[model samples]
Target chain A: MLDVRFSDVRLPSGPGVGYKPQHFNDILKNAFPVQWLEIHAENYMGDGGRPLAQLRHLSERFAISVHGVGLSIGGEGRLDPEHLARLKHLVGWLNPASFSEHLAWSTHDSHFYNDLLPLPYTDATLTRVADHIDAVQDAIGRRMLLENPSSYLAFEESTWSETDFLHELTRRTGCGLLLDVNNVFVSAINLGYSPQGYIDDYPLDMVGEIHLGGHDEDTDDHGAPLLIDSHGCEIVDPVWALLDYTLEKSGPKPLLVEWDTDVPDWQTLAAECTRAQAALAKVPA
Target chain B: MTTQSDFEGALLDANKPVPAGLSDGSGRPAGRRYWVYRNNVAVSLGDALGTGFPAISKLVGPQNFKNLAAIFLRQHPPKSPLMMHYGAEFPAFLEGFEPLKHLGYLGDVARIELAMRQSYHAADATAADPTQLQRLGEAELMTCRMTLAPAVHILRSAWPAASIWAFNMVPGSPKPQAKPEDTLITRPEFDPMPHVLPHGAADFLIALAKGATFEDALKVAQSNAADFDLGATLNLALGHGAISDILS
Candidate 1:
């Protein structure tokens, strides 16, 4: 089969929310400001069920973004063929407006840890990640977007900065970027860097989408502040401020507010979208 | 070189120290910062199991279940990336784990919950023509082969597993009696509903699932229970959308 190049499909530069099953009816009834919906690629992979049915119904009414939590694109081992095939099958049918995966590894030696594990941004690691992204884009016949992970600690072996690493990935594989601003905040605070400086260095033109979410505050061993990307609460003020700063630089992109844990009712989530829309409004795209 | 190899190992095992060369931005040893990754991995996988086996979690209490999940996850880390497909071995794990040995029925309850999840996700199917079975003569009916829906699942347990599940999950359900039960899980629509099978129905269903003719299946059920009510069992199956087709 001939490998198709990255898709020309695009999502509107408006607020979107991570699709949740509990909010299905509410979204269909009144999804104001939410121009698109993003779903975790792994959730809808079943052969046939309510999940697929709901997705099918929603896709007809809204532009869908297939955001992958798995795929372990930075793993040392080769990508799991079966998982890649499942992803391909979903993309084949869903034909979502966008597709994205993380810049981290969750699977190693057959055991999926069920959490996004970080990677050192060394030259060898960059090549491996680029290769995995290339394979994914080839398999699904579409350009993939890679999202940076929230960091708790940095590796001394990493020679490249996170932004430089992401820039090189897009340069190498022709993939886009999913700039998760909340992750930027979490990583900056945890690693003693400036979030705004990180955004300035990021290759924003290649970013297909942007993400905002919440974090939990804790302290490292030295009692320095550490933020865990919990995604359980409303987007905090500082993160929203960071989003405003990021928009000032990048203008409007397909912004998403992810509340995966302790998900609020439709009204609460929609309010977040309203705030995101206001942020996009500030930018003169 | 030692990056992923040692990193993943420490994520699963709490005792393992933070991998070499990892530190906070100030170059301090990673220390408690490494626990962030460890907590994410343990808490997320544990939460998945807790959601997967709500009845098991309820029976063992939340804290005990969390500890069990920690151990179970280490022993059987998900081979698949799909979170729903994780914890396939948990029911068996409960059956053999020495600490939970006294609660022998916990495994069976877990089985029912797993079956319900599977049934909920099983392929959609058209119900078999309900009138077709009634139209056939007794001899013809016995000779015909019935196709079961992909959503149909039978679990025969020595404990009243279905009853126990109902007591825990369903409000105002009766307390479980100490008796054997055979559970038939079916998805007539979107949600899976578990029905307590009458005596010997499991034999009949198991035989039918194995491609036995109606005559053979009925004989198996009747042999198991001399007074097996074939009509009631057939009504239950037909009404619940368990049968997908009738092949003569």
Candidate 2:
């Protein structure tokens, strides 16, 4: 068996916040014990800028992970060589402690939508995803972790459960899993599944990183509950509880607090990181 | 089995009343779910543009930016999956946009920002050692073919774009009085820095960027403005780390 160990991952005990350029001075001045800092890979793709300067400074001071929103790894047609080249360049440049991307597809033909769209979980889809992952890993010269996406609806064409699809993809491509507990909870609530059951059956050994974020709850026109992974607000109480349950089962992993929209001040996010740390402390690592 | 064409068809046209490629377990229409996918596609692309061009967003309020982005997406959808480099043609779009023609400087401002972004993401290269200039005789130095780093970008504008960009970035900064200004953007280190170039600097840099020798570039600069100072021009290029190679 290949030695795929995530023992190097240094997850925050409680909630951690996304790094914002607004807090550049604050981060530089204060030695905040935030568990880790997660950055959107595309934002710092520049060869040189304040973003790269700040990220390079912070990476030396804290555990850094590159979370990519653009790769469109599951997109139809051939994988984008340019996008893969950029990703490889970034991986070579940063040598981040961990790297991850969404399972959703965001590109079609040559046009990039820049959104993570849902994919049908079928045998053919799994094979395509495995091939993509394999290509990405080969390009970057490092293993990547794939995160499960929060879906509003499931297609009837899906022949496998989300868990089985992710597990099989990891098994086939040798990629790690970035088990987004918030997504699992949101998808379960929207698609009418037991979140607990899904968590219980997940491939825990493959999970290298965890994501906690907020979602919007609304009812569809037909009155069916719909949950959207907005990541605009704080991690709600239910998602927090779900994260706690997931950590208990998966053991301690790198947990990221993702709040992309309506971002609060640095301290407010730092406080959330403290909460994540406290949650992880409750788990016996 | 989903072929590449099937997947492409489904994603390209989310509003395809009855999508040809996708089907639910039963022989039923999956029209409603397509809406979710479509919304995600539009929102994310718009957001990417907004994020990449925050200055553009601020210049044109959120509502206008959204409207502009909607049109721009259809006309110039991203060619690459990388969002950072997604809106290269936005400034060009703004140039021809009917609604934005009233703000003549808006396109120039966008061009300035785009130049800054382009310089920021341009490949990293070491600046030519200043000591090399000392090795050449005065005549040789004047005629030396210097290579400007690819990271250096010079943009000419009829509006004071650098001043405008500074005002927008700095809070409580005075609104820039509309005046024609040329701008220089260079990434000496990791971040791209923008500065207002003195008169004739744009012509000089443009000449150099076109592979002109130092003397030839100086002639272009002097012709553009009789008072063009060679020392000042060289200082500006050297200060920004734009000069990367020199050959006798």
Candidate 3:
């Protein structure tokens, strides 16, 4: 019943970019074809400020999505009610077109880590994650898209493969997936699995949105290539190829281009978004 | 059955030698993966503090900031996942922090910055109608109770924190001469702007904040600063939209 599919939602044409104050003047002046803007929910959690003011202005002009980084949904304990209240407050204020959070946990024992940490894929883990997701959706009174995370290491105790875990989560919670193609490629390379196989097994029908971001390539202690989801540079060719393959299967979804660190100008990020749009357009929807 | 609480308990332990039972694919212990989780938590919280308090970070270099942030994070893991409001206790922490006591004014500067952030994020409410003050005759205006704006913050300090913060924030601005200063932060528009208040402003605002009538606040202000100007001070507050309502 909570199937908010991409086919139901029409994403704006052309590319979208992250909203930053440094590029405010440029954003206002340039008549560029930027369609949407994504903001970190935690940044605007306060009562009011320049950040909110800018977001208000941008929101009026474009489609906005609230991408959260600190829910810690996969943690072993109960969800933080205080954090949930703040998120609910932001959702009420922004009323964004879409909302998303990572499938990782970031807190333990009442201490917040503030990063999207990986969760093991097990029946026990799956049930806990599904319950957490259900709690979040219930609290906010809306369905949310859960993104796949880029992991640097794998846990030995994971009983289920990543694909099966995601499929089970969607099945149990009735939540949609925000498939990050770059993450699949990163995990596949690091854990020595076929990225294509993972994609083939992915619950494509449950995918509501897609994220494309850059990664860092570092060698492990064994000198083998290790990909970290740095989100700092341009989307590499392999990730793009993976994206192409995903679009072919899942059809065009609301794709996002994320760049957090050492961010370039608005135009540079827009160019990356344009690439995603072009790839999505080429897919037979 | 790994209960949500059980999974959370394991994830919170930063020094876990191995992942124990939580693993995906390659069969590495959950402990090694938790290390990545630990690093991300510390780094992100540290980065959030850095971003929220840029002036503080600029005063102390990135390396020192990160080191201090790690220590601070261990002591004060954020109460909320809302990272923007994460460093509310940082100023108090800096005051008692033994290593940074030599800086003397760093804590007060942090207080000033924190107040500015609070003002910025305070709830949105309309300013008290100036006409409400008009109905009260001149005598009443001088003696009637005034309600300060929820968004206004008054910070009294022994260091010229407002001036120091201003000089550092503005590109190429001259450094402030060392002197004790009281600061008033207000969000008339969207962003909180910090202003250096004359000596009596802090005492005067404190009285007003405490629900004292204008006359009582004036008396406190005069006692705090021998040459307090009640008219000018009231005018400054009114102009800045820092006074939300006047309760007769």
lDDT on C-alpha atoms for all candidate structures: 0.92, 0.78, 0.78
Per-residue lDDT value at A245 in model 1:
92
Residue lDDT tens for model 2, B82-126: 566778898889989987888777787888777776777676778
lDDT measured at residue B101 in model 3 versus the true structure, 0 to 100: 81
What TM value does model 2 have? 0.86
Judge candidate 3 at residue B227 and give its lDDT: 84
List where candidate 1 sits over 4 angstroms from the true fold: A1-9
Better of 1 and 2 by lDDT: 1
Give the Å error, residue A276, model 3: 1.2
Residue-level lDDT tens digits of model 1 in A216-270:
9999887899999998999999999999999998889989999999989999999
- Fnat of model 2, as a fraction: 0.49
In candidate 3 chain A, what residue range of length 10 has the lowest lDDT sum?
A4-13
Winner by DockQ: 1
Compare candidates 1 and 3 on DockQ and give the better one. Answer: 1
Task: Give RMSD (Å) of candidate 2 vs. truth.
Answer: 3.9
Model 1 pairs in collision: none
